[model samples]
Target: MNNHVAPRAAGKQVFITGAAGGLGAAMARMFARHGAKVFLTDIDADAVTAVADEINRELSDTVAWAATQDVRDEAAWIERLDQAAKAMGGLSVLVNNAGIGSLGSVEQIELKEWRRVMSINVESILLGCKHALPYLREAQPASIVNISSLAAFKVDPDYAAYNTSKAAVAMLTKSVAMDCTRQKIDVRCNSVHPAFVRTGIVAPFYDALGEEEATRKLTRGIPMRRLGEPDDVAYAVLYLASDESRYVTAAELVVDGGACAI
Candidate 1:
């Protein structure tokens, strides 16, 4: 990606889930900085509202609206998208970034918790695509950036639910892309797999371990010898969301600091 700023996404309309803090907020800022009008959504209404306020103030050149929804709710998806469309005039990009982490083995995880994780992490993707694809088709040459984790390609005994959920996200990205091709839609779908980024999403992992231990564990196998920045993933998202990735679809963009390569 270019280091200097240019309005690559000028006049675009973007709707992002989990847009309160961490990577979601980072991507929202990046999109706005690139000149797209953004709609920020999160289950945490106050946090998302604060996020929208911050973005509006910080990036006065672009526009943003805020909404809150449980991503797992199909009705919420429809209603939120309707409001987002009206707020932004149209929808051009959808970022399925809302998700939660689960830290337990299958035997250790309760069935209800497993279902809850699945609902938030996986079902939400289905709901987003189902509700957004129609409007996305109307706004052709649009993009969907699904935030799958590098855990999808990895495994840990204590993270079965999260691993499974993210793995579903990875495959669903491809399926959505192929289906769009079949229907001859110009919308592209892709997933990003970020490993050990220093974001609130990884806070639980850090808290489970102390700061020093958590840092060591998270960065243990990565070649870069450090955790990733939110901007690292956000830049990749910006590229995917912009017209620059027009030819790219049904792909996994790994921002793992070369850990996957190892």
Candidate 2:
């Protein structure tokens, strides 16, 4: 993790979903370290609270708060955003980072699984962007960073549902961005597409094939020859959530280490 602290996000109030672990946890830490007040949420109540406590302990300040949330629930989105905005004075950044991965080819995948993937990965983003707009607008110069995936661009036969959901995220981000711009809202919307990173989401690969072999297999196509660290993607998100990318909206920031270049 980067130790250098910068006030890039000072005074920014950020709400992040799926912040119990992996990329979401990394993002929460990154934002808090840089002076942003973060409200972290996840379905995992215990884990999410632990993460918040850890961040506060590290910073020795009350810059992070924790809550349990089911991103798929529209009611939860409405209530949580309100609570967060009230707690932090206002909501300046919404990181739609809650998502899930699926396996099975098109014909082999079950309808229920497909629906599950769509609801959590795609619909949740819609709910978040739609409901958070008011708070974000009130806190002008806000940003919505949707965490997409390199899978949206690169296909895998067994990842039918996962691929489709992420692709939807990419386009949905653009739609939201355009709407906000046309209406002269100061909220910026963008997507971050990160390739495989060393996170809990990819733990299955490591468990099946030893870490060394899994690393080799996963990095074979990446030019960097290594799986990306959570901070790698977290940094990209920080840039978009901060004032640095004020003019950058409706853009796809790819952090795949040249995977898409091939």
Candidate 3:
């Protein structure tokens, strides 16, 4: 990586799942901009390749490489991590950001949908940590940032599967952090809970309400009076990934614009 800031991440290696999409791609650019070698992967191979290519072109650092892997597959997680370790030279950060969104009540959503969401949202984080633990232990001073949601802490009747999965993520992060501490591993694990981010998953939902109506309705519960942007959560992820949050672990960083604050 080149043109790096004079800060901690100047030479670090970071691996981000869901690299083909919104938050994941933003994270890749943010870390690369700060001089980190980023390994990118997603189920959508072409999209991830474009993201990596764009990052390399924009930064002239040649710091990103893309791979195709389904996060729901545990064996694929191991393969991807090993590949990322080789590509980035070593793995120092892992962002478990790949997840799906679903909208339905418990009675409304099919069992298959619930299972799929759990497999991707909650199970993938577990697999990522399980497979990457050895590499993180070896590297020492590593970080795992799992992308959870504000719905994890709130009751969203329309999105039971998503809410349940994110809730599991919160506890999963804590469990991983505790195990790392007990095992004498110099690793930090935390979950980020973002609310109503204006990403693809939420855009269509908002589109039905229209921009003005959606803005008013969504912010009604949030004291911050706005929906979060991808960069908003990206900054939080960067903080947790960097040494600045070295003393912070097993914590839930709520990036919900104070929605749950009230």
Q: TM-score winner among the candidates?
A: 2
Off by over 4 Å in 1: 1-6, 204-212
Tens digits of lDDT, candidate 1, 1-262? 4768668887789999999899999998898888899999998999999988898898664388898899988999999999999989999999999999888997899999999999999999999998999889999999999999989997888999999999999999999999999999899999999998898867887789988988888898899988999999999999998899999999999999998887
- Per residue, candidate 2 scores C-alpha lDDT tens digits across 1-262 of 3557558899999999999999999999999988899999999999999999999999998888999999999999999999998888899999999999999999999999999999999999999999999999999999999999999999999999999999999999999999999999999999999999999878989999998999999999899889999999999999999999999999999999899999
- Which candidate's lDDT is highest? 2
Q: Which is superior by lDDT, 1 or 2?
A: 2
- Candidate 3 lDDT over 118-159, as tens digits, reads 999998898999999888887778999999999999887999
Cα lDDT of candidate 2 equals 0.96
Our model 2 lands, by Cα RMSD against the true structure, at 1.8
Q: C-alpha displacement of 213 in model 3, angstroms?
A: 1.4
Clashing pairs in 3: none
Report each candidate's C-alpha RMSD, comma-separated, in the order given: 2.1, 1.8, 1.9
As a whole number from 0 to 100, the lDDT of residue 66 in candidate 3 is 96
The lDDT values for all models are 0.92, 0.96, 0.90
TM-score for all predictions? 0.94, 0.97, 0.95
Clashes of each: 0, 0, 0
Q: Once superposed on the true structure, which residue ranges of model 2 sit more than 4 Å away at CA?
A: 1-6
- Position 101, candidate 2: lDDT: 90
